[model samples]
Target: MEEGRSSKGGVKKEYKGGITPFVVGVSIVAATGGLVFGYDNGIAGGVTSMDPFLRKFFRATYRKMHQEEARSSAYCKFNSQILTTFTSSLYIAGLIASMVASPLTRLYGRKPSILVGGLSVLVGAAINGGALNVGMLIAGRIMLGIGIGFADQAVPLYLSEMAPKQIRGALNMGFQLFVSVGGLSASLTNYGTDKIQNWGWRLSLALAAVPAGILTLGSLWLPETPNSLMETQGPEKARAMLQRIRGTLDVEEELSDMMEATKTSEMVKHPLYNMLQRKYRPQLVMAVAIPMFQQLTGINAIVFYAPVLFRTIGFQTNASLMSAVILGVVGLAATVVSMIAVDRYGRRLLFLQGGLQMFVCQVIVAIILATKFDSSGDGSISKGYAYLLLVMICIYVVGFAWSWGPLGWLVPSEIFSLEVRSIGQSIVVAVNLLFTFAIAQGFLAMLCHFKYGIFLFFAGWVFLMTLFVYLFLPETKNIGIEEMNSVWTEHWFWKRFVNQEFHIPIGIKTSSNT
Candidate 1:
């Protein structure tokens, strides 16, 4: 690598020391928590139409009802309500867990917080898999929610702190990509088990415990993040950990940057004040607004209730579960595209394009759902509209994965200043969980009343979010965490997103190759 001058009249210093395998390994291990998150969501979403699932909890009777009696239309509607409660129960516990994350992370450090979270997930799985009644199942789902709430915020925060500036976006996106893998695994697992007797859905729910166990065990052996180590053990220990993680002895430059950032460390103790300060107002706005819009896209409603959505669109029980598998694959592939593009094209471009694409998919689906099918007749969708619905749903997932999935996690983690970074993350994560719960729990009600209006509702949000990104959010490609404040302060709205031509170029200090 060599130094040079750019057309913008800035000096450039290149980096030759590459990232080591250990860093990559640790990043993957830390991100496996995301696998548990996805698996949990998929298992709940996929199990709704399983005969075993419906008969076991929804229609099981001490009143002498048999298999044929359990399939009654009245019984089916009641099952929908139970299934909705079962899935939403996880979120209630998750919302509670996320609200308390600041205290948990403060007392235990990142590693232990995640370890406990993983164990909680495994315990929840056991409870859910072995349940013999609806009450027990709801109890288990609540525990699962608590566990996912713990991992949801902690994993991304750890990844964002551990990764180098060169590949930070990729590593963070990897967290989300693995989430899709967990989803894919769940969908395949459900498809494999969909034909079994009453035990099939139980097996699907229990299978996720394997990944949670892996996450717990892997995190136990990993080192604490550099930022956490620096705060607790001082610079020498932090530097040693950084060298080991980065696989380089020449860490003086990054070390200096971290030291300056650490000066704001006091605010972590009193994060609420810092988060509300005048200086941080804009970043806080961006953090809250983006995640809010992300949920408003109805992505979680799709993730947690896709089988139900497809059921309305005319697919049979097992076929709807299989369709979810396809959606999961499409989502995984799109996330890979985001991992590649996030660093190169920047967050703003992806958001701008992804939002518009999602709106297009939603509008087409909405028009067909609104007019083409008779809601009062057979619940099965016509073949023409069903195929169209499937394709559009998959495309909507592509748009979501490329923009909201990774960016929602990455932006909130990166936008805040150091003082409130951790707590700001919890608040943002809590908001996401809260909205997810609201959307998931309330979606069935929305569908009953609004029909295609629900899709139109989400489409309108997409348009608003697209405008929000273009006007308010700045591109945060390779900027240092310490330098994010300057980006928000840029006066010209148009100048905020375009790179190189803008006033303060990304990668910070143009003389340095980060």
Candidate 2:
């Protein structure tokens, strides 16, 4: 028994290694894309105050009309749509651009692909900041979308590949953390400059370029992924990179294991084709389902329209922006909690707990709105119920941050094997971007048309998500990549409900043929 225990310890020692400084360095550099993603998403809300510049541009381009005529014109009402087009076109472009990530990552390697993404963002930011009209802004946003597409697809994958198995979830989730930070930064910047209308919005939009520049410069110093190095180069170069990354000279066994993993990954047939095949249908379902539910939770509606929602609940403009900042703070805090809890308590537990909490909060908010308990005369809302609505929004944000925000990215990368990971994750992100575009485009209209019914619609969806997660998601606490397929296929209930859960762990011995 002592000898058996000793053998187990030996095996564990082989699995464990020193921290990889290069990996840490590279992850920070790559995560700039996440910052760009967050900044672009959040900046538009604040930029809406640039009505003077927009009006000037509109007046300069078209025939002058009387003040009353301009006030009542269709362009006045649809000015927001023009801005939405500028902003949301990036997401649409991202959705289309993500389709290329699998091949791009394969051809260029993750690092170079990320560099190209950063450059695109920089160019987009410059164009957007210098835009003379809505058309130019839309063009810039399209370029930004291309950047986002590459970063969203590559950064998470790069993080997952470089991370140690034990801490992969936490490290991968760093993307979400940076996203929250970027959002918070944008909020604070906007709030600080709210009094200065001329340059505030442009500065807010351009600030995103700083991170992209830094990341682009920093990428030059980082090492490529060992897997990428091996696949593209040869064994010796791969071994050297592994040594530098792992800070260990004795990487013969580790190198062998990685080579075998890569070879097996290569032998697997066309991943995109396989993803659509029956054999991989379960994984494909999971990839699509998680992101679908993530967007359907209406987090974007709240984030994108927080100030509007707050004002609807009775807050003044200054107060509404302040409340939005508070909401962002709550979201950041909840994400920090998730970062700590995800690895400790595991992914499934958080999803179940967070989904249920979100459902309850949504129901409460919907009920309050539906009953007209807080409505003011003249189509305005009362301020008395602001605290109640704020509390509910905070609760919903917490629920989303702790579960869906990070896990939505983490799970898909883990669920698919390396063979199909690129395509699988791209599909997941594409669906996410698509739904994000759809929701962002239609959310205000839906709210305007359906009133409080929109909240109820989201509430119903949250409840459904809670049921799905409770019944289907699997526990993937400390599983290795090679074991994923067996774990997924063996458990009948897990296989059936895999779409509901984030990551389902499979236990398989690499040495066994079975």
Q: Once superposed on the true structure, which residue ranges of model 1 sit more than 4 Å away at CA?
A: 1-17, 60-81, 491-514
User: On residues 1-514, what C-alpha lDDT tens digit does candidate 1 reach at each position?
Assistant: 1232232334433332467888889989989988998898888887876766776676642122234344332113323455688888887788789767766674456787788779999999999899888898888888888888888768887888888767889998887998899988998998889888768988998887988999999989878887777666678887887898778888765665566566657435677766776556676777678778889998988887787678767787778888899999999999999999998999999998999999999999889877776665354457988988999999999999999888988888877665677777777877787888778788877776677788999999999999988878877777656455556545365333334432342234545434
Model 2's alpha-carbon lDDT is 0.71
* Candidate 2, 1-514: lDDT as tens digits: 1111021121221343667766667776766667777777776665553344445444431232223344232112223455456557888999988888778786567887788778888999898778877788788888889888888888888887777667778778888887887777777766776666566667767777976786677667666777678778878988887787667888776676567667766886677886776657767877888889999999887877676566555566567777778877888898889888888889999988898899889888888776644332323445656588888889999999889988888888776766677788799889999998988887756765666777788888888877877766666666544445545544556455334222322221222444
Q: Give the lowest summed-lDDT range of ten residues in model 1.
A: 70-79
Backbone atom clashes (below 3 Å) for every candidate? 2, 2
Instruction: In candidate 1, list every pair of residues with a backbone clash.
Output: 314-380, 314-381
Cα lDDT computed for each candidate against the true fold: 0.77, 0.71
| Superposition error at 447 for model 1 (Å) | 0.5
